[model samples]
Target: MLQSFKCEACKSNNQPSVSNHKDNSHLPDCKDEISLNTIGVIKTMFLEKRAVPRQASEAARIISRIELNSRIFNNPEHSLEGLETFSHIWILYYFHRNQIHLKSKVAPPRLGGERVGVFSTRSPHRPCPIGLSLVQLDRIDNGTIYFYGTDMVDGTPVLDIKPYIPQYDVPRKIERQEFFSPREAPDGEENCESVKTASTSTSGNLVSNVTVPNWVTNCKYLSVTFNETAEQQLQELAVEKKSITEILRADPRSVYLRTKYGSQIYTFQLGENTVTCKFDDQNSIVNVLQVRKVVILGDIPVSDDE
Candidate 1:
């Protein structure tokens, strides 16, 4: 035998009541009861926190504080004792900023900057609003835990914490999919020679195979180009690309400067290697000219004179 229930929030008429038996007289209809205080709140020193990274792995040096409630602090020290050995720790917390219910689809910055399903992408808007992050554990003291490289905002409530075990988590071999590919360089000189020979036999033009830099590999945006000239222009603008990249990578509105183009303040969107600006005036159009004397961080083309 089963019981039928009606929700108080939606009213009895809106929701359907089902019982093991078809007879309505056998089961009485009632509303479902739920408890809201399942999780505890966390306190931190960062109150007016801004420009926080969207992912914890990106910001691996910035320090932040975390405080757990005293009621559930039993064996907290024992739980965190083995965490010092691991390089990274997984933080499971709630997204206090999200106000809407979880949707089936979400707009992800990756996936060619398109909307993906909630299950596929890590969006803040969800039924639980729970956020998970792999952050570096710097130190742990009493009820307060200090972490580095966190995307969580100040005063965010923490649900749980777990040490990241590379042996158990890392797969022995991963099959590449169309959306994601392995970043490691190819092995063996013989294999490389064979590839070069095949390429030479097909076309005379020697195609130089180069590995992509770490900075470019980690970039989320596809439109940006990290050439020398582009970097030089960014440097001339009195902005550091590393720092600017951090700001632009996350929510741009949080990091972008409010500048007066004409009369109104317009926010600029930055790419991995390019900085884009918009004018408030309707008549003005954005354009980019040739760049000169760009700072080259990695392997770049050189002239005969140099």
Candidate 2:
């Protein structure tokens, strides 16, 4: 059975904009309430609170699935019409983990602990805890969207999904990228086309496509060849070069840590294992030295560092 309804209580503008200006002042707090429906739930390998990536870019190889709510689960063939044409899709979801707190300002590590208005940054502690992410569309089968590049947690309530169209979405030219911070575009690097955000959450309240910085694409990545021990062990598990590329390219570190640590051992929690590597800034290579099983504390797999 197909069902639909019109909501006039809280009107939302879906058009893309530089800033989100939602006028909620008119509605009285005493009587105003807006309810949103959950269309699906996202299934991911990231189970721990800290295990998830800060943004979709870091989750390039992270395969996840979106299973539509059984209420709307019937007839995937009709519901997912014309969606296969696009290579990427936008996912709007609720940040279930961020419901505990809300704040107006936060210290963003990207700026070395500088305080900024919460609205200006992508911190999870905001007025609204909605999260938006762009991911590679693998294929939709039996009403499940199997995708890569997810930044959300397990059991996330998905509100909606939309295909990505580059023609209308990408702007021809920009007057100035003043909206971007200096840390995003360094002083002497070629004017980077895109920027990598260390955003923790979103306000589907205001959402858009995820764009990776051109610098990241152009950055030198040394050929990754495993040591004899690593190669022998990896063969048993059958890991691919493509998976390694996807994981390392998206710098997996806190904004504050990635900025100061020139040469250090960084570990990432992927699935049941912890990948430990040393990043060589001079040559711009990540040498994956070892992979070990993550220790379970409570119900989540934890890295030794944590």
Candidate 3:
């Protein structure tokens, strides 16, 4: 005999319960595996997606061009014939600059120090680092499709392009999340009161002849002095932290105290700045000492003097 049950939510009594059902081994594997490289590569001028905006709506009026391969271009017109009617198109591309191994949890810049699940964040580190951008389509001529308001970095490879449909894509009402607040402008504008004119050189460098903003000029710990060994480790840490921290305590060779004289590795975490070096290895420290004025070249790691 078969058993019957009631629906808890609606209080209906027509539903059947499976508490006494016998198991049958007739189910097949449900994994659907698709082959990769099924689609051809899309060559574009964008290289890295980090420089791309977190959302496509943020970028407006930025022009970018997409070119398809000759094979795909043979019938490109047929594939994109009616695409121009749509105001916006969805661009799917690969993130070529993801360095860290794909992780399920990522530290988003907006979250400060908190670690959020990768699915909740728009992190590039995923099973496949694919990016989606809703770009404004300007025109399509031959195999080239010109777009505007693109956030993709120069030389980024595009994967696919699909026209955005308002009827299907637009949401009725979006529930707000805690971290969905708009970004605020920096508070340094108040300090710009004394600023007169800001000019840049032909080489694209800011040539500031006027006095710096009061916020920056009034900083007491602007200049940091460190020994060669300590300076090197600080440089390494600066690259990782992307911010400069003043060194408060001074103890030369403090980082190398753990190891014997020959194999000593010295490192120090000064505020947000971190420096690392090996005993007798002064190459990294020497480079940091040379740039005392500002924390320049923080991205590149230097070898310690050996």
Best TM-score among the predictions, by candidate number:
2
Candidate 3 per-residue C-alpha lDDT over 1-306 given as tens digits, one digit per residue, 9 for 90 to 100 = 234532352234332344333552332223345433312343332333322444445445445777765564567667777777667798888766765456678765344346767776666677667877888889988767888755566666677888765433543333355259455335322222222121111123223222433432342222233456545654654442222221211113222232235335434432223344333333222122322112335775333332
lDDT of 2 by residue, 1-306 (tens): 112222332234333222332563434233345688899999886664553666787668878999987787667557787677668899999888776346678865445466778877666666778888989999988788999897877889999998764433443333255457354334334221232121112223123544544432454334444556555545655655456555565455566665678668876655666667777757767677766656889987675547
Residue 276 in candidate 1, Cα distance off native in Å: 15
Which consecutive 10 residues in model 2 have the weakest lDDT in total? 196-205
On a 0 to 1 TM-score scale, where does candidate 3 land against the true structure? 0.44
- Pull out the clashing pairs in model 2: 203-206
Of candidates 3 and 2, the better by lDDT: 2
Which stretches in model 1 have alpha-carbon errors above 4 Å?
1-50, 74-78, 111-113, 174-245, 249-306
The per-residue C-alpha lDDT of model 3 at residue 247 equals 24
The C-alpha stretches of model 2 lying farther than 4 A from their native spots are 1-32, 172-228, 255-266, 278-286, 293-306
Put down candidate 1 lDDT per residue, 1-306, tens digits, no spaces.
Answer: 236544453244554545444786644445345334323454432232344556776555556766666667575565566556656777788778778575788654433335666776566778778889887777888656787775666678877777764433432332246238434344321244544454455343222433433433565431222456556676666544454444333433321232222423222322122244332224333222212332334665322223
Q: What ranking emerges by lDDT with the best candidate at the front? A: 2, 1, 3
